[model samples]
Each structure stands twice: as C-alpha cells, then as structure tokens.
Target: MSSNLLEQLRKMTVVVADTGDIQAIAQFKPQDATTNPSLITAAAQMPEYQEIVDQTLLKAKSDLGAGASQEDILTRAFDRLAVAFGLKILEIIPGRVSTEVDARLSYDTEGTIKKAHELIAQYEAAGIAKERILIKIASTWEGIRAAEVLEKEGIHCNLTLLFGIHQAIACAEAGITLISPFVGRILDWYKKDTGRDSYPAAEDPGVLSVTKIYNYYKKFGYKTEVMGASFRNIGEITELAGCDLLTISPQLLTELQGSTTELPRKLDPAKATAMTIEKIAVDKASYDKMHASDRMASEKLDEGIKGFTKALETLEQLLAERLKKLEEKAAVGV
Candidate 1:
C-alpha cells in the first residue's frame, strides 16, 4: 500500500519534510525540507542537537572575535544556526531547503533583501549551491517586493505565512519561485470562530483558499509554485494532495507513512484552468484595499509577524548566553 500510494502521488507533487531534526527527515526521504525560527529553537533544546547549537555559537565567537558584542554575536549566531540546519537538511534531501529570514524584517524591504542574500551566501559558503536554497520570507507586500528583486538575481524564494488570495496574487505578479499558504492555520482561525471540526475538502474554507490561489495562477499562467503548508491534520493534506508541494511536519510524515490509504490528486492545473479566475494585480492602492478587505488576513499577518519576532528574540537570547559561556571558556581554558 505504501509503495502503491508513493507511485501514485510522486508524479503530481513534491513532498517536503517540515522539520529541524535531520534524522526524522532522513527516514521519510522527502525531496526537500524547511525550517523556521520556531523549529530551530525547538531543535536546539534537544540533547541530540546540543552539539549543533554549541558548535554554531563557538563559530560565531571565533568569527566575530572573543570580545564581540552580544548584538553582533547574536546576529551571526542566528545565521550560523540557520545555515547549520540547512546543511544537515541538504544532506538528507535531494532538493532545496527553505531557510527563513528574520520575520521582523517582513515590512522592511531592504532588510529582507539583505538577509535573503546573507542566507544564500551562508549556504554557498557551506558548499551548498544557490540553486538548492530557497530563502523563506513572510509574505508581506514588502517581502514580495524584496523577493522580486532577489528572483531577478536568480535567487528563488519561498513566500510563507501567506493566508489570502491578495497575497498570492501579489506574489504571482512579483514572479516568486514559490508560495506557501498556511492551510491548517487558516482552518484554525475559522474553526475558532465557527466551532466546527471538518468541512468538505472542496468547500473547506482553507482548502478553497489554496484552490483559489492555485486556479488563479493556472488561469493566468503564473509560474509561481503553490505549496500548501502549516497543516493541522492529514485531512488538509489529503485535500490539497496535488499541490506543487506540501511541507509536512515530522509527526504528520510519520502518520502518512503508517497509513495505507490511496493517495490521489485533488488539485490539478488542468482542471483549474477550466474554471474562471479573475486576472488581478496589486498596485499600491489595491494592496491597501485588499488588506482592509480581509480582516482576518490583516490581523493574522500582524499576529504571525509578532509571534516570529518574539521567537527570534528568544533564540537570540539563547545564542547570547552560549556566546558568553564560550568566551569565558576561551579565557579560562575549558
């Protein structure tokens, strides 16, 4: 059953492991893998990953000098962690690893662009090719614009935290390499308000959101890839089975591995092309209008941005403590 399901779905979609633990990712043999601030933070706490974090901080201290300021050490250490994770992920997956930039830079076009390049440079320095890296950025209008510049330079991007058609349409217009709509996150917000467990896959609000984005891209011949992400359960995954890609967490990956159900293509570009989709673009005014039009998108965008920012701060704090310890050790001869 596993072999049959793999055969059926392998052609229609790219399977990516959404994890920071390289061991779990290796077990599933996903084509790609992704990591964000939260995953990195969680992984750093694992005893198995203590060496990875310590080594990263030690590298930061050496590169920045033992007396480097905490701010400098923290900034470089974050990069170290991301690169270390990306390198490990690349070793297990045949395709790219999506490493996220600091989410605090979502509204800062120049900062986002600079960090994206820094991430790509880190990968290259680690002996990974640029073609195998996809810098993940929050899908703010600023982020989309930043990605446009990066894409022109041959750096592909994975636009994440995307929750609305407006964001998707703008990303398509910007010619992004990929867009990751949060399927379960969308369903979560809706469920909180409506108090429901399930919806028909086709009519599920979250499902419809991704389907709309997919159809719009297909109808307009946009090359931007649609990768459904942030799923709450297997149902959402099954609902969007034919997405260009799906980044599943380790727990979900394990569930899929254990299940013997038939894997089918639920989202097809050919079928999408048969549906009517309005051609759209987001000029400055329209972007503002859409932001206002979708209350949930606006609120969630800010909330998600804040959540990632807080996590980044926590990670930075952790790196600083480690850096201080390493500095003391170098002085006293550990």
Candidate 2:
C-alpha cells in the first residue's frame, strides 16, 4: 500500500478528475472525468484550447450553411463544443466522460432525454461507444425520469447536483447508473445557514449527508453507485475515503499526492448492511414532500441550475464574439 493519501484512498475508491482542463487530466490521470457547462466554458476560453473552440465553431457554421441564424449556429456549436471536449477527455481516461445536457432542460424530461441521445450520437459518430460516455442530468424528478428511460436503452447516466435523500432515493429507484452527491455544496449551505465558519470534517453536513446516502444504498443492495463530488477541502475528501468514487478538483488531487497520511476506510458496505436502518419507500409524492422540507437540497438545487444556466449564457456570448473575429480574419484573407 502506498503511503500517499491519494494512492491509499484509491485502494478503496475510484478517483475521478472533475475539471475540463486537459493538462490537469493528463497530469493526474484520473480513471474518469466529468465536465459541466461552467468548466467547459472556462476551458474553452483558455488560449491552449483555442484551436478546439475554433474548430467546433467553424464546423457548426459550415454544417448549417448559408442563411443559418446565429442562434441556430450557437445552439449546435454549444452541443458540439461539449462533445469535442468530451472526446479529448475520453482519449486520456480509460473509463467514462460525463457530458451534461443543457441546464435549461433540468425540469424538462422529454427535452433532457432527447438531448442525451443527441450527445451520445455525436460521441458514437467519432467511433466511441455509449458505455464510454455518461449523460449528466440534474437530479430533478424529471431528470431522474429521463435517466430511467436512457438506462433501459443501454445509455448510462450520472444524476448530478444531488443534495438530499429524496433525490438520491428517487434516482436509485429509477435505476440510474450513478449519482453524484455534492458534498461541499451541502456543507456550504449549512455553514451559511448556521452562520458558522466551519464544521469538523466528521460533523460536516455534506460528509454526513453522503455517508447517509452511501449506507442506505449499500444496505438496500441498490446497484446504483454513489460518487461524492464538488468537495471544498481535503477533510471532506478524506472523510469519505472509501466511497464508491470521488470526483475531485486538480488542486485537491495535488494536495493528496503530497500528503503521506494513511487513509482509512470510513464507508463499508458490510457495516451498512448490518446496521438497523429503516427503509423509506420513495415515489414522486414522498420525494416531493421530503424535498419540500429539505431546505438545503431545494435551495442548492435551484441555485445550482441558475448558476450553470448563467455560465452557459456567458459561453454563448463569448462564442459569438469569437465567431465574429474568425469571420473577419477569413474575409481579410490573412
């Protein structure tokens, strides 16, 4: 066993890189990688990836041909831009890459499902398989329902922005492949709500929340996997050391690589199964009722969607500016 905490932790959990930066992914070599609109937009702006951004834009404009509205080009370009990044990520990681559907479709089940198919088709067109791509949808009841339909078609999904048990249980019951409970986001809510600076890693609201969800899934023998995501610090990551997976940012991954502390398993399936925990039957009615009472989940879910939507709007505007520059250069025969 390696003494490094990152290596030690990997013995029990699948480590995933959670950024859109290709250099970081190449450096850390995580098993899987995940990207959202915000990360993609940020990475697309980086000078190193300008070629990727330009190619996606050029292709989108060309495919639409003459008289295509700028809106149509922008929409198609965003979709292709996301997949272009996914393809680059997939080339580096042996596992899967999650490409999210538009956040605006978070509550639209039919639209989410349709978008997932479109993303998957783009990946397949590049000779990648559905198994190597995970469609990331928000954990709304509608999103979970959309995932249920995709899973049956052999397209796996990752239910993201999940904060409460209601959403987690609903995703599991829907037979979703994976659920990424936002550990740090949950903690952020509690700290702001309680007016505290910090909580001990053990008592952190996010850690406790994911621990509860992890055990519940294990105890019930649910096949759905729990991947702890959006961590704020090393404590939260180390606290959930034995989780099925942890999607971490590059900074934290570097810290773990530098630390030699021995990591211990905090979540065990056998222990969970032996504990006496009551089973709660979750459906739309119960999920709605429970979610309504869970302030952190509701608030965070709403805020998270709005945040991603704003990022996407920023990206569209940035792309428009970039497209104009490219067109001007081409017209000048430079």
Per-residue lDDT tens digits of candidate 2, residues 138-238? 99999999999999999999999999998999999999999999999999999999999999999999999999999999999999999999999999999
Question: Best candidate, lDDT-wise?
Answer: 2
What are the candidates' C-alpha RMSDs? Answer: 1.6, 0.9
Q: TM-scores of all models?
A: 0.95, 0.99
For model 1, the stretches where C-alpha displacement exceeds 4 angstroms are 1-7, 197-200
lDDT of 1: 0.86
lDDT of 1 by residue, 15-82 (tens): 88888888888888899888989888888778898789999888887898857787887888898898
Top-TM-score candidate index: 2
Q: How accurate is candidate 2 locally (lDDT)?
A: 0.95
Kindly give the stretch of ten consecutive residues in candidate 1 with the minimal lDDT sum: 1-10
